[model samples]
Structures are given as C-alpha cells and as structure tokens.
Target chain A: AQSVAQPEDQVNVAEGNPLTVKCTYSVSGNPYLFWYVQYPNRGLQFLLKYITGDNLVKGSYGFEAEFNKSQTSFHLKKPSALVSDSALYFCAVRDRYYGNNRLAFGKGNQVVVIP
Target chain B: DAGITQSPRYKITETGRQVTLMCHQTWSHSYMFWYRQDLGHGLRLIYYSAAADITDKGEVPDGYVVSRSKTENFPLTLESATRSQTSVYFCASSESSVETQYFGPGTRLLVL
Candidate 1:
C-alpha cells in the first residue's frame, strides 16, 4: 500500500520569508507525487507534481517542490511567502508500479503566512 | 461555467436518510473521482469512474455508492446517511488516469 505523511500540523511563516512544508512517502515501487492547496470553502487546486524527471519541480503561484529520492521526501517550498498564501496544503502519492492509479493523501498542513 | 461543478453546495440531513450528490464536468474527462475531506484526514477517495459505466471502489467505499451513466456526470449516493459520513465532498475529473485532476467547488454535507 502507498501512503504519505505530512509531519507538521501547521507551518507559520512571516511575509516575504521563505516557507517550506515537509512531506514523506512510503510506496512499493517508485512514486508519483503531487501538491495541492485549498482555500476556505474551496476545492483543492493542483500546485505541482513530480513524475520522473528533475528533482526540483516548479508549480503554480510561485511554488516549488524538491523530490529527494534518497530520503523519500518531497517538500514544498516558496522563495517568498505572501499573506494571501495562507491556506491548507496537501501532499499525495501514488505508486508507479500499481496500475489502479489510486492516490493516498496525507493529513494536510495548514499554512499561516503572517504579515 | 467551463469547469467541473457539484450540485447542492451545502446540505443537512438526518440519520437513515438517503442523500445523493451530483457532479458534472464540462471538460468531458474520462476519469472522475469522489473524495471526502475531514479535519484530520485530508481527503479520502470514496469511489472513481474510468469511463461511462465503468466505476470502482477506492480507499474508503464502505458506505458510498457511485455511478457514471455519461462521460460528464458522476454522482455519489449515500444509501443511509450516518453522522460519521458528514464531511466536505469534492468531485474531480482528469483527462486520463495519469493527467492532472481538476476539482469542483465541493459539497458540504451535515448528517445529524
């Protein structure tokens, strides 16, 4: 079975400061990872994904994530945080070898960007 | 108007009642998914449909039922509502299984 773990419940960062949300995964084979953001009373929006290429993947709204194969971690990052960026973030993973195309999601991390 | 949409954005129902959530996508994607979001659990897939008349169970499918009669419509039905079934339900669609999924605004259901 494939699973994802977001170790932090919430991440607090100041405006204009670098921000990071950590994620780790356990899968039978290689993994397909993705990040999504959800605003209040809104559905999730896709941010980025890591498939098979470079370790560093860039995504929407100036967000990026690094896929470290050795550590089995895919952490979302932003060079500068904005107050509007405060929202709930989720990390999901699917096992590549599995043909079902089912994704296992983490509990989510609430991001609070302080101004 | 051009994206996925879910009907009855908010609903409140009593236990033992039957509730049906409707989802429609204008993109005509081949894959549709139903997920429930709670406080601690980010999102758990209740069911998914690959194409018209082709549906399957996901991580959590015990109390939910899904049907896809057409390419654009995928509705989830709860035969008997329970308090534990109360959550925000999101419907998503993808061009294919490996493609990025687009989600609807979500329907918030309260089972009392």
Candidate 2:
C-alpha cells in the first residue's frame, strides 16, 4: 500500500526560529513527494516536490524540503519561521511505478508561529 | 489570468436537494481533479478526468457524479445532499500525469 504519514497534528514555534514538519511515506517503488500549504479559507498552494536529483529541494515562500531515501522521509523545513508561515501543511506521495497519477495525502499538520 | 476556478464560492442547501459544482481551467491541462477537505480528514479525492471525455472515480466518489464534456469544464453533481457531504470542494488541474497541480479557491458547502 502507498501512503504518507504526518506524525504531528500541531506544531508551535516562536517567530524567527527554525521549524521542521516531519513526514514519512511508504510505497512499492520510487516515491514522488510533494508539500502543500493552506492558509485560512484558501485553497492549498504547492510548496515543493522531490522527484529526482538533489536531496534538498527549494520552493516558494522561502520553504524547502529534504528527501531521504533510506528513511523514506521528506520533511518540510524553513531556516527562520515567520508569523505568516503559520498554517496547515500537508504531505503527499505518489508511487512512480503505479503510474496512476493519484496522490496519497497524510492528515495535515497545523503550525502556529507565535510572535 | 490563466488558472483554475470554481463557481459558487459558498453554498447552502437542504437535505435531499440536488446541487452542482462547476470547475473550469484556462490552461487546457490534460488532467483535472476534484477533492473535498474536512476538519480532520485532510483532503480526499472524489473524481478526476484525464481528458475531455475520460473520467474516473477517486478515493471517495460515493454520492458524487462528475462529467467532463469539454477539456476546460468539469461539473460535479450530488443527487441528494446530506450533512456528511458538507465540505470545501476544490478543483485542480495538472499538465500531465505526474506534474504539479494548481488549485482554485475552494467552494464551501453547508448541508442542513
């Protein structure tokens, strides 16, 4: 079975502090991972994806994610957290071997940045 | 102004009432998808279309019907609305089978 797991339901951080949101995935073959963010009353926005190549992938809104094949983990990270970065985050995965194009999303994580 | 859009930003309907949600994209993408977002369930797929006439069910397709008569338009219909069906419906489009999906501002529905 292909699936993604977000271990934390909510994470709190102080402004200007570094933050990390953990994600793990299970798949039969190479996994295509993606991160998305949703602000209040807004649709999800694409954050970044790891298909191949570099282990560290950068994305919009000063966010980045690191893909670890050995651990099957793709964790979203930011150097310094901002109050505006507080929102709901989702981790998703797709098995390349299946080639079905459907994604498996984990129950989202809520991040709160306290100023 | 090339992006995905969903009609009826907010809707309120009674039980057993039929409702339709419309989705349109200007990018002419080959793939379109519909998903519902709830409080704790995250986002669940309802249906998708590979092209103008090829449609398929997703993870949670029950109580939902979808038709894609054209490449740019995909409409979802609910034969009988229920309280459990109340959610934020989002429409997304992707250029190909494995690509980044662009989402539209979702439509929030409340069933009483």
Best of the candidates, lDDT: 1
What is candidate 2's CAPRI-style docking category based on DockQ?
high
RMSD, every candidate, angstroms = 1.0, 1.0
Pick the DockQ winner: 1
Regions of candidate 1 where Cα sits further than 4 Å from its true position: none
Give lDDT per model, in order: 0.94, 0.93
- Model 1, range B11-31, lDDT digits (tens) per residue? 999999999999999998999
Steric clash pairs (candidate 1): none
DockQ, computed on Cα atoms, for candidate 1: 0.86
> Between which residue pairs do clashes occur in model 2?
none
* Candidate 2, superposed: residue stretches over 4 Å from native: none
For model 1 chain A, give the 10-residue run with minimal summed lDDT. Answer: A95-104
